[model samples]
Target: MSTQFLDMRISSDSVQDTPQRELTSSSLFPYTFGDIGLQTASVSPSNVNSVRVTLNAYVRLLMAPSSNPTIIPNATFTVRRNGTTIFTTVYQKPANQLDITYEMAAITVVDFPPENEVLLGQIQYTISVSTNYGIGLGARSFSGIAVAGGI
Candidate 1:
């Protein structure tokens, strides 16, 4: 039941809505989506008018270093939306040691990597340090940085 999250990253989303209904009275539900509360669905007044729909997903997470990396089975891992775990994931720390490579393609983000990448909007991790590594108990602890963005 142990969980791990690596290469964690936060993403954002935005949805637009219009204040107009496109339905006819002939239809049982004059509202656009009936009772789904869609853009065309009446909000102010049930029979007054139509409306637009808008939704956005906000994402945010923390990425810290595990004080005891040498003793841990893996450096870092990733957290899944469906509550799953992935192994051998790499986490970039706050330093010049991080590596970056770019290729022109259909994808617009690093999360699209085929070999060691993950889907959008997922991030979390855990680890165990050797009893002798780091500054003792303090060595196995690292700070997590918060990263978030979207296109």
Candidate 2:
């Protein structure tokens, strides 16, 4: 079966030398770093059955030492759709490391069957980050895209 592309949407925040945002909570909470909104055309489930989402970001994580030197530093990146979690990625600093930075990408495909396909209208995508042992985020560029397609 040939696939049909129904819609596509993109959003981004590109800021050079952006100020660092401190994250102190070890728990995984909604700390929004980026967001995007996509409006999908109303279609029958037989016509479109899935949405492909891609997220990219440049992140800098600076680990601050805690009172106990042995505690490891870690950070988590999460992707949510309409207030529901769709994907999550975790970064753990190597033992004795003080800081790290990198560009990360996450992708996921959401499937809908004909009987229960309910994803329609306006959709919201959110990106959140959290760290343990205190960490700073700086000079970042975050982007996301949503593509609705069917086979």
Candidate 1, 1-151: lDDT as tens digits: 1122222222211121222122221334211110111121111222121111112111111223344443321112232212233222332333432222111111111211211112222222222111111111111111222222221
Residue-level lDDT of model 2, residues 37-132, one tens digit each, is 655555445545565545565656666655566777677888777777777878776676544543333434342322232355556767777877
What lDDT does model 2 reach?
0.59
Off by over 4 Å in 1: 1-120, 132-140, 146-151
TM-score to true structure, per model: 0.17, 0.70
How does candidate 1 fare on TM-score? 0.17
